[model samples]
Target: MFQNPSNEAIASILKNAKTIAVVGLSDDPSRESYAVSAEMQRRGYKIIPVNPNVQEVLGERAVASLADLPEPVDIVNIFRRSEALPDVVREAVNTSAPVIWAQQGIYNEEAADIARAHGKTMVMDRCIMVMHSLFVRGA
Candidate 1:
Protein backbone atom coordinates (compact mmCIF):
# COMPACT_ATOMS: atom_id res chain seq x y z
CA MET A 1 0.00 0.00 0.00
CA PHE A 2 1.30 3.44 -0.93
CA GLN A 3 1.09 6.19 1.63
CA ASN A 4 -0.36 9.53 0.53
CA PRO A 5 2.07 12.37 -0.21
CA SER A 6 3.35 14.65 2.50
CA ASN A 7 1.61 17.97 3.01
CA GLU A 8 4.62 20.03 1.93
CA ALA A 9 5.07 18.15 -1.32
CA ILE A 10 1.35 18.19 -2.06
CA ALA A 11 1.21 21.89 -1.37
CA SER A 12 4.17 22.55 -3.63
CA ILE A 13 2.74 20.50 -6.45
CA LEU A 14 -0.63 22.25 -6.26
CA LYS A 15 1.05 25.62 -5.99
CA ASN A 16 3.14 25.06 -9.11
CA ALA A 17 0.58 23.36 -11.30
CA LYS A 18 -1.37 25.94 -13.24
CA THR A 19 -3.44 23.60 -15.39
CA ILE A 20 -5.28 20.61 -13.92
CA ALA A 21 -7.00 17.99 -16.06
CA VAL A 22 -9.71 16.53 -13.82
CA VAL A 23 -10.43 13.04 -15.05
CA GLY A 24 -13.94 11.67 -14.43
CA LEU A 25 -15.20 15.06 -13.41
CA SER A 26 -18.99 15.20 -13.23
CA ASP A 27 -21.46 17.99 -13.91
CA ASP A 28 -23.04 17.58 -10.50
CA PRO A 29 -21.73 19.87 -7.79
CA SER A 30 -22.39 17.26 -5.11
CA ARG A 31 -19.85 14.96 -6.71
CA GLU A 32 -16.28 14.84 -5.44
CA SER A 33 -14.87 15.73 -8.85
CA TYR A 34 -17.07 18.80 -9.12
CA ALA A 35 -16.17 20.05 -5.65
CA VAL A 36 -12.43 19.58 -6.13
CA SER A 37 -12.39 21.09 -9.60
CA ALA A 38 -14.43 24.03 -8.38
CA GLU A 39 -11.97 24.64 -5.57
CA MET A 40 -8.98 24.30 -7.91
CA GLN A 41 -10.55 26.77 -10.30
CA ARG A 42 -11.30 29.14 -7.45
CA ARG A 43 -7.64 28.95 -6.45
CA GLY A 44 -6.63 30.06 -10.00
CA TYR A 45 -5.67 26.79 -11.66
CA LYS A 46 -7.41 26.19 -14.98
CA ILE A 47 -9.67 23.15 -14.46
CA ILE A 48 -10.08 21.02 -17.57
CA PRO A 49 -12.94 18.59 -17.13
CA VAL A 50 -12.24 15.15 -18.58
CA ASN A 51 -15.35 12.98 -18.80
CA PRO A 52 -17.04 11.42 -21.81
CA ASN A 53 -20.50 11.78 -20.28
CA VAL A 54 -20.40 15.56 -19.94
CA GLN A 55 -20.09 18.14 -22.70
CA GLU A 56 -19.37 20.84 -20.14
CA VAL A 57 -18.74 21.18 -16.44
CA LEU A 58 -18.13 23.95 -13.93
CA GLY A 59 -18.76 26.44 -16.75
CA GLU A 60 -15.83 25.16 -18.81
CA ARG A 61 -15.79 23.01 -21.96
CA ALA A 62 -15.15 19.35 -21.15
CA VAL A 63 -12.93 16.96 -23.03
CA ALA A 64 -13.57 13.27 -23.35
CA SER A 65 -10.02 12.35 -22.40
CA LEU A 66 -6.72 13.84 -21.33
CA ALA A 67 -5.37 13.04 -24.81
CA ASP A 68 -8.06 15.34 -26.17
CA LEU A 69 -6.87 18.32 -24.19
CA PRO A 70 -5.73 21.33 -26.24
CA GLU A 71 -2.29 21.58 -24.69
CA PRO A 72 -0.04 20.00 -22.09
CA VAL A 73 -1.54 19.88 -18.63
CA ASP A 74 0.53 20.27 -15.49
CA ILE A 75 -1.51 17.89 -13.37
CA VAL A 76 -3.81 14.97 -14.14
CA ASN A 77 -6.24 14.74 -11.21
CA ILE A 78 -8.04 11.42 -11.35
CA PHE A 79 -11.53 10.96 -9.86
CA ARG A 80 -12.12 7.43 -11.10
CA ARG A 81 -12.19 4.15 -9.21
CA SER A 82 -9.21 1.85 -8.66
CA GLU A 83 -10.37 -0.41 -11.48
CA ALA A 84 -10.30 2.49 -13.95
CA LEU A 85 -6.97 3.89 -12.79
CA PRO A 86 -4.62 1.98 -15.09
CA ASP A 87 -5.83 3.49 -18.34
CA VAL A 88 -6.02 7.00 -16.92
CA VAL A 89 -2.52 6.75 -15.45
CA ARG A 90 -1.14 5.37 -18.70
CA GLU A 91 -2.65 8.23 -20.66
CA ALA A 92 -1.42 10.75 -18.14
CA VAL A 93 2.11 9.42 -18.23
CA ASN A 94 2.05 9.30 -22.02
CA THR A 95 0.98 12.93 -22.01
CA SER A 96 4.02 13.68 -19.82
CA ALA A 97 1.97 15.44 -17.17
CA PRO A 98 4.21 16.39 -14.27
CA VAL A 99 1.76 15.15 -11.66
CA ILE A 100 -0.85 12.38 -11.40
CA TRP A 101 -3.21 12.85 -8.47
CA ALA A 102 -5.64 10.13 -7.45
CA GLN A 103 -8.48 11.57 -5.42
CA GLN A 104 -9.44 10.44 -1.92
CA GLY A 105 -10.48 6.79 -1.67
CA ILE A 106 -8.87 5.96 -5.00
CA TYR A 107 -5.68 3.97 -5.13
CA ASN A 108 -3.78 1.80 -7.63
CA GLU A 109 -0.22 0.84 -6.82
CA GLU A 110 0.58 -0.53 -10.24
CA ALA A 111 -0.67 2.60 -11.95
CA ALA A 112 1.12 4.82 -9.47
CA ASP A 113 4.38 2.93 -9.97
CA ILE A 114 4.05 3.24 -13.73
CA ALA A 115 3.53 6.97 -13.43
CA ARG A 116 6.46 7.40 -11.05
CA ALA A 117 8.70 5.28 -13.24
CA HIS A 118 7.85 7.55 -16.11
CA GLY A 119 9.20 10.50 -14.09
CA LYS A 120 5.76 11.79 -13.17
CA THR A 121 4.84 12.65 -9.60
CA MET A 122 2.09 10.44 -8.17
CA VAL A 123 -0.20 11.48 -5.32
CA MET A 124 -2.76 8.86 -4.37
CA ASP A 125 -5.88 9.19 -2.22
CA ARG A 126 -5.33 12.84 -1.47
CA CYS A 127 -7.67 15.79 -1.89
CA ILE A 128 -6.27 18.53 -4.11
CA MET A 129 -8.52 21.16 -2.57
CA VAL A 130 -7.10 20.52 0.86
CA MET A 131 -3.55 20.70 -0.44
CA HIS A 132 -4.35 23.90 -2.33
CA SER A 133 -5.37 25.59 0.90
CA LEU A 134 -2.07 24.63 2.46
CA PHE A 135 -0.15 26.23 -0.37
CA VAL A 136 -2.37 29.30 -0.77
CA ARG A 137 -2.43 29.84 3.00
CA GLY A 138 -4.83 32.62 4.06
CA ALA A 139 -5.57 33.69 0.52
Candidate 2:
Protein backbone atom coordinates (compact mmCIF):
# COMPACT_ATOMS: atom_id res chain seq x y z
CA MET A 1 0.00 0.00 0.00
CA PHE A 2 1.20 3.47 -0.81
CA GLN A 3 0.39 6.64 1.08
CA ASN A 4 1.01 10.31 0.54
CA PRO A 5 3.10 12.29 2.99
CA SER A 6 1.57 14.20 5.85
CA ASN A 7 0.29 17.76 5.40
CA GLU A 8 3.21 19.05 7.42
CA ALA A 9 5.70 17.36 5.16
CA ILE A 10 3.90 18.64 2.10
CA ALA A 11 3.95 22.16 3.50
CA SER A 12 7.64 21.88 4.15
CA ILE A 13 8.32 20.84 0.59
CA LEU A 14 6.22 23.65 -0.81
CA LYS A 15 7.80 26.19 1.51
CA ASN A 16 11.36 25.23 0.67
CA ALA A 17 10.89 24.60 -3.01
CA LYS A 18 11.75 27.50 -5.33
CA THR A 19 12.04 25.78 -8.66
CA ILE A 20 9.75 23.24 -10.30
CA ALA A 21 10.22 21.37 -13.56
CA VAL A 22 6.75 20.65 -14.91
CA VAL A 23 6.91 17.60 -17.10
CA GLY A 24 4.32 17.32 -19.88
CA LEU A 25 3.34 20.96 -19.49
CA SER A 26 1.40 22.01 -22.53
CA ASP A 27 1.83 25.20 -24.52
CA ASP A 28 -1.89 25.70 -24.70
CA PRO A 29 -3.35 27.87 -21.96
CA SER A 30 -6.51 25.78 -21.85
CA ARG A 31 -4.69 22.75 -20.57
CA GLU A 32 -4.73 21.76 -16.93
CA SER A 33 -0.95 21.57 -16.98
CA TYR A 34 -0.69 25.11 -18.23
CA ALA A 35 -3.22 26.43 -15.76
CA VAL A 36 -1.59 24.71 -12.80
CA SER A 37 1.92 25.66 -13.81
CA ALA A 38 0.82 29.23 -14.40
CA GLU A 39 -0.66 29.45 -10.94
CA MET A 40 2.49 28.08 -9.40
CA GLN A 41 4.53 30.56 -11.35
CA ARG A 42 2.33 33.43 -10.15
CA ARG A 43 3.04 32.25 -6.63
CA GLY A 44 6.74 32.88 -7.23
CA TYR A 45 8.06 29.41 -8.04
CA LYS A 46 10.24 29.22 -11.10
CA ILE A 47 8.51 27.12 -13.73
CA ILE A 48 10.54 24.97 -16.05
CA PRO A 49 8.47 23.41 -18.79
CA VAL A 50 9.51 19.93 -19.88
CA ASN A 51 7.62 19.11 -23.02
CA PRO A 52 9.27 17.92 -26.19
CA ASN A 53 6.40 19.04 -28.37
CA VAL A 54 6.45 22.70 -27.35
CA GLN A 55 9.12 25.29 -27.71
CA GLU A 56 7.93 27.36 -24.76
CA VAL A 57 5.24 27.70 -22.14
CA LEU A 58 4.53 30.47 -19.60
CA GLY A 59 7.43 32.35 -21.16
CA GLU A 60 10.03 29.71 -20.28
CA ARG A 61 11.82 27.65 -22.84
CA ALA A 62 10.62 24.05 -22.81
CA VAL A 63 13.11 21.26 -22.50
CA ALA A 64 12.85 17.99 -24.37
CA SER A 65 13.50 16.01 -21.22
CA LEU A 66 14.33 16.35 -17.55
CA ALA A 67 18.00 15.65 -18.28
CA ASP A 68 18.03 18.70 -20.51
CA LEU A 69 17.53 21.14 -17.64
CA PRO A 70 20.49 23.45 -17.34
CA GLU A 71 20.34 23.43 -13.56
CA PRO A 72 18.91 21.24 -10.85
CA VAL A 73 15.32 21.94 -9.82
CA ASP A 74 13.68 21.43 -6.45
CA ILE A 75 10.71 19.47 -7.70
CA VAL A 76 9.89 17.46 -10.81
CA ASN A 77 6.10 17.90 -11.17
CA ILE A 78 4.59 15.41 -13.57
CA PHE A 79 1.39 15.86 -15.56
CA ARG A 80 1.64 12.73 -17.66
CA ARG A 81 -0.85 9.89 -17.63
CA SER A 82 -0.87 7.26 -14.87
CA GLU A 83 0.52 4.55 -17.18
CA ALA A 84 3.53 6.72 -17.97
CA LEU A 85 4.50 7.45 -14.36
CA PRO A 86 7.02 4.64 -14.02
CA ASP A 87 9.07 5.78 -16.98
CA VAL A 88 8.85 9.40 -15.88
CA VAL A 89 9.80 8.51 -12.33
CA ARG A 90 12.77 6.57 -13.60
CA GLU A 91 13.98 9.72 -15.31
CA ALA A 92 13.12 11.98 -12.37
CA VAL A 93 15.11 9.87 -9.92
CA ASN A 94 18.23 10.52 -11.94
CA THR A 95 17.84 14.26 -11.58
CA SER A 96 19.11 16.36 -8.71
CA ALA A 97 15.57 17.33 -7.78
CA PRO A 98 14.68 16.07 -4.35
CA VAL A 99 10.95 15.86 -4.96
CA ILE A 100 8.95 13.88 -7.54
CA TRP A 101 5.31 15.02 -7.70
CA ALA A 102 2.62 13.46 -9.82
CA GLN A 103 -0.44 15.60 -10.40
CA GLN A 104 -4.04 14.64 -9.61
CA GLY A 105 -5.33 11.42 -11.12
CA ILE A 106 -1.80 10.15 -11.69
CA TYR A 107 -0.56 7.37 -9.50
CA ASN A 108 1.55 4.23 -9.77
CA GLU A 109 2.98 2.10 -7.00
CA GLU A 110 5.98 1.21 -9.09
CA ALA A 111 6.70 4.86 -9.69
CA ALA A 112 6.40 5.67 -6.01
CA ASP A 113 8.73 2.81 -5.12
CA ILE A 114 11.31 3.93 -7.62
CA ALA A 115 11.26 7.50 -6.31
CA ARG A 116 11.36 6.38 -2.69
CA ALA A 117 14.23 4.01 -3.41
CA HIS A 118 16.18 6.88 -4.83
CA GLY A 119 15.58 8.91 -1.64
CA LYS A 120 13.28 11.31 -3.46
CA THR A 121 10.18 12.68 -1.84
CA MET A 122 7.26 11.13 -3.71
CA VAL A 123 3.89 12.87 -4.06
CA MET A 124 1.36 10.91 -6.08
CA ASP A 125 -2.19 11.60 -7.20
CA ARG A 126 -2.14 15.11 -5.80
CA CYS A 127 -2.57 18.47 -7.44
CA ILE A 128 0.46 20.68 -6.94
CA MET A 129 -1.60 23.85 -7.29
CA VAL A 130 -4.16 22.69 -4.77
CA MET A 131 -1.50 21.53 -2.37
CA HIS A 132 0.28 24.83 -2.61
CA SER A 133 -2.92 26.73 -1.99
CA LEU A 134 -3.65 24.59 1.04
CA PHE A 135 -0.20 24.16 2.54
CA VAL A 136 1.56 27.29 1.48
CA ARG A 137 -1.04 29.98 0.89
CA GLY A 138 -3.27 28.57 3.64
CA ALA A 139 -6.32 28.65 1.46
Candidate 3:
Protein backbone atom coordinates (compact mmCIF):
# COMPACT_ATOMS: atom_id res chain seq x y z
CA MET A 1 0.00 0.00 0.00
CA PHE A 2 1.18 3.52 -0.88
CA GLN A 3 0.50 6.65 1.10
CA ASN A 4 1.02 10.29 0.18
CA PRO A 5 3.09 12.53 2.42
CA SER A 6 1.52 14.53 5.22
CA ASN A 7 -0.43 17.67 4.37
CA GLU A 8 2.30 19.81 5.91
CA ALA A 9 4.86 18.15 3.71
CA ILE A 10 2.70 18.67 0.64
CA ALA A 11 2.30 22.30 1.62
CA SER A 12 6.04 22.64 1.90
CA ILE A 13 6.51 21.11 -1.52
CA LEU A 14 3.99 23.52 -3.02
CA LYS A 15 5.50 26.46 -1.21
CA ASN A 16 8.99 25.76 -2.48
CA ALA A 17 7.97 24.90 -6.03
CA LYS A 18 8.02 27.63 -8.64
CA THR A 19 7.68 25.59 -11.81
CA ILE A 20 5.58 22.55 -12.75
CA ALA A 21 5.89 20.30 -15.76
CA VAL A 22 2.42 18.99 -16.45
CA VAL A 23 2.40 15.72 -18.38
CA GLY A 24 -0.68 15.00 -20.51
CA LEU A 25 -1.84 18.55 -20.21
CA SER A 26 -4.50 18.99 -22.88
CA ASP A 27 -5.01 22.02 -25.11
CA ASP A 28 -8.74 21.93 -24.53
CA PRO A 29 -9.77 24.18 -21.67
CA SER A 30 -12.60 21.81 -20.80
CA ARG A 31 -10.12 19.10 -19.92
CA GLU A 32 -9.20 18.80 -16.28
CA SER A 33 -5.53 18.97 -17.12
CA TYR A 34 -5.89 22.27 -18.85
CA ALA A 35 -8.09 23.74 -16.15
CA VAL A 36 -5.75 22.67 -13.39
CA SER A 37 -2.57 23.71 -15.14
CA ALA A 38 -4.13 26.99 -16.14
CA GLU A 39 -5.08 27.67 -12.55
CA MET A 40 -1.58 26.84 -11.40
CA GLN A 41 -0.19 29.18 -14.02
CA ARG A 42 -2.53 31.89 -12.88
CA ARG A 43 -1.33 31.34 -9.37
CA GLY A 44 2.27 32.26 -10.39
CA TYR A 45 3.77 28.87 -11.16
CA LYS A 46 5.36 28.46 -14.57
CA ILE A 47 3.65 25.55 -16.37
CA ILE A 48 5.44 23.45 -18.93
CA PRO A 49 3.06 21.19 -20.80
CA VAL A 50 4.27 17.72 -21.74
CA ASN A 51 2.08 16.25 -24.47
CA PRO A 52 3.17 15.05 -27.88
CA ASN A 53 -0.36 15.53 -29.19
CA VAL A 54 -0.45 19.29 -28.65
CA GLN A 55 1.91 21.99 -29.83
CA GLU A 56 1.12 24.21 -26.90
CA VAL A 57 -1.08 24.63 -23.86
CA LEU A 58 -1.63 27.59 -21.55
CA GLY A 59 0.89 29.62 -23.57
CA GLU A 60 3.75 27.19 -22.94
CA ARG A 61 5.19 25.05 -25.67
CA ALA A 62 4.22 21.42 -25.21
CA VAL A 63 7.09 18.99 -25.21
CA ALA A 64 6.83 15.40 -26.35
CA SER A 65 8.21 14.06 -23.10
CA LEU A 66 9.93 15.03 -19.86
CA ALA A 67 13.28 14.62 -21.62
CA ASP A 68 12.37 17.52 -23.88
CA LEU A 69 12.12 20.16 -21.19
CA PRO A 70 14.48 23.09 -21.73
CA GLU A 71 15.14 23.48 -18.05
CA PRO A 72 14.64 21.68 -14.77
CA VAL A 73 11.31 22.10 -13.04
CA ASP A 74 10.40 21.94 -9.38
CA ILE A 75 7.70 19.36 -9.89
CA VAL A 76 6.41 16.94 -12.52
CA ASN A 77 2.63 16.92 -12.45
CA ILE A 78 1.08 13.98 -14.30
CA PHE A 79 -2.48 13.70 -15.59
CA ARG A 80 -2.10 10.44 -17.43
CA ARG A 81 -3.91 7.15 -16.77
CA SER A 82 -2.91 4.89 -13.88
CA GLU A 83 -1.48 2.24 -16.22
CA ALA A 84 0.83 4.83 -17.76
CA LEU A 85 2.28 6.05 -14.46
CA PRO A 86 5.32 3.80 -14.25
CA ASP A 87 6.77 4.91 -17.56
CA VAL A 88 6.08 8.53 -16.73
CA VAL A 89 7.58 8.13 -13.29
CA ARG A 90 10.64 6.51 -14.79
CA GLU A 91 11.13 9.46 -17.06
CA ALA A 92 10.42 11.95 -14.32
CA VAL A 93 12.98 10.32 -12.08
CA ASN A 94 15.61 10.92 -14.72
CA THR A 95 14.95 14.61 -14.59
CA SER A 96 16.04 17.19 -12.03
CA ALA A 97 12.53 17.70 -10.77
CA PRO A 98 12.31 16.68 -7.12
CA VAL A 99 8.61 16.01 -6.92
CA ILE A 100 6.38 13.69 -8.98
CA TRP A 101 2.69 14.40 -8.61
CA ALA A 102 0.07 12.13 -10.17
CA GLN A 103 -3.27 13.86 -10.59
CA GLN A 104 -6.42 12.86 -8.74
CA GLY A 105 -7.45 9.23 -9.28
CA ILE A 106 -4.17 8.27 -10.94
CA TYR A 107 -1.87 5.93 -9.07
CA ASN A 108 0.29 2.83 -9.46
CA GLU A 109 2.37 0.96 -6.93
CA GLU A 110 5.13 0.37 -9.44
CA ALA A 111 5.36 4.06 -10.10
CA ALA A 112 5.42 4.85 -6.41
CA ASP A 113 8.19 2.34 -5.86
CA ILE A 114 10.21 3.73 -8.74
CA ALA A 115 9.90 7.28 -7.46
CA ARG A 116 10.78 6.25 -3.94
CA ALA A 117 13.81 4.35 -5.17
CA HIS A 118 15.07 7.49 -6.87
CA GLY A 119 14.59 9.58 -3.71
CA LYS A 120 11.83 11.57 -5.35
CA THR A 121 8.81 12.82 -3.47
CA MET A 122 5.71 11.22 -5.02
CA VAL A 123 2.19 12.48 -4.53
CA MET A 124 -0.24 9.93 -5.89
CA ASP A 125 -4.01 10.07 -6.37
CA ARG A 126 -4.35 13.75 -5.55
CA CYS A 127 -5.32 16.96 -7.27
CA ILE A 128 -2.48 19.50 -7.47
CA MET A 129 -4.87 22.41 -7.97
CA VAL A 130 -7.02 21.38 -5.03
CA MET A 131 -3.97 20.83 -2.92
CA HIS A 132 -2.57 24.18 -3.92
CA SER A 133 -5.85 25.83 -3.01
CA LEU A 134 -5.94 24.07 0.31
CA PHE A 135 -2.28 24.29 1.30
CA VAL A 136 -0.73 27.04 -0.78
CA ARG A 137 -3.53 29.52 -1.43
CA GLY A 138 -5.49 28.73 1.70
CA ALA A 139 -8.77 28.57 -0.14
Taking all chains together, each candidate's TM-score versus the true structure is: 0.91, 0.98, 0.98
What TM-score does structure 2 among the candidates reach?
Answer: 0.98
Cα lDDT tens digits, model 3, 41-62, are 9999999999999998888888
Worst 10 residues of 2 by lDDT: 130-139
TM-score ranking of the models: 2, 3, 1
Lowest summed-lDDT stretch of 10 residues in model 3?
130-139
lDDT of 1 by residue, 21-115 (tens): 99999999898789878987887889889999999998889999888998788899999999899888999987857889998888998997888
Could you give me the TM-score of model 1 versus the true structure? 0.91
* Whole-model Cα lDDT of every candidate shown, in order: 0.85, 0.95, 0.95
**Residue-by-residue lDDT tens digits, candidate 2, 1-139:** 7899999999999999999999999999999999999999999999999999999899999999998998889999999999999999999999999999999999999999999899999999999999999988983
Error of 3 at 8 (Å): 0.5
Off by over 4 Å in 1: 1-3
- Cα error of candidate 1 at position 89, Å: 0.3
Better of 1 and 3 by TM-score: 3
Off by over 4 Å in 3: none
